[model samples]
Target: MNRRKQKKLTNRLVWAAAVGDTCTVRTVLRTGVDPELPEADGTTALYAASVHGAASTVRALLRAGALPNTESRGITDGTPLCGAAAWGHVATVRELLTHGADPNLREDGGAGSTPLFWARNGASGPHPETEAALVAAGATD
Candidate 1:
């Protein structure tokens, strides 16, 4: 695919993930879109799905080969695990961890925040299950 087509398809995939549309995500991935394609501002489908608490979408994307630790560069730039945990999505966090997501990765924007930091301090309030999942994964190290 040409760069333009690739970018467009990536955008579609990201949007689909953000909206928790599993069918669209699967369709987009079927077209050969790179699961980790970051939008111009750096948002990725996996990050979008995670932040939206779209567990099934996250699972589909991960099974489609999305990197669990992939981070974006744009306004929403963040790791999938961080996004999931920050939003109090225990299932999503657990799924990412099951896929080997590194919970200790600092926010790519250079902040000291890890998934645990976000889980413990999300604006949505603390999510004990998310935080516990991170600890169980050795994130405190």
Candidate 2:
């Protein structure tokens, strides 16, 4: 496939995971698609799954060798860990951490904030499960 087609496939996989379509994701992966491929915004399938609280998809991507610390698009310079924490996806956070995601990994520039910070500062729901997950993953703050 050409570069453009490959990129389109990668974006589709990311979108599928983000939307919780695990079957479509698996089908794409089985078709020799690259799991680590990032979207135009630099968001990977793992990152999308993390933000969407798709634990199964996240696990599958990890098993396929997706990088937990993969950076996202724009000036945010965020990682999948940050996305999981920001979205309060506790199970996803746990899965990412178990797969070797660094809770202390901060974004570039002056963000300098860890996944724990994001979990603590960004969470707004009733459960706070993301923060709990970050703590379980060894987050200090």
Residue 55, candidate 1: C-alpha displacement in angstroms: 0.8
Superposition TM-score, candidate 1 onto the true structure: 0.94
Cα error of candidate 2 at position 56, Å:
1.0
Query: Which has the greatest lDDT?
Result: 1
- Tell me the number of clashing residue pairs for each predicted model: 3, 0
lDDT of 2 at 77: 54
Residue-level lDDT of model 1, residues 1-141, one tens digit each, is 999999999989989999999999999999998998887778999999999999999999999999998787769867888888888999999999999898798887557589999999985999998898899889884
Worst ten-residue run, lDDT, model 2?
A: 120-129
lDDT of each: 0.89, 0.80
Which candidate achieves the best TM-score against the true structure?
1
TM-score, one value per model: 0.94, 0.86
Q: After superposition, how far is residue 1 of candidate 1 from its true place, in Å?
A: 0.8
What root-mean-square deviation over C-alphas does model 1 reach? 1.3
Which whole-number lDDT from 0 to 100 does residue 84 have in model 2? 79
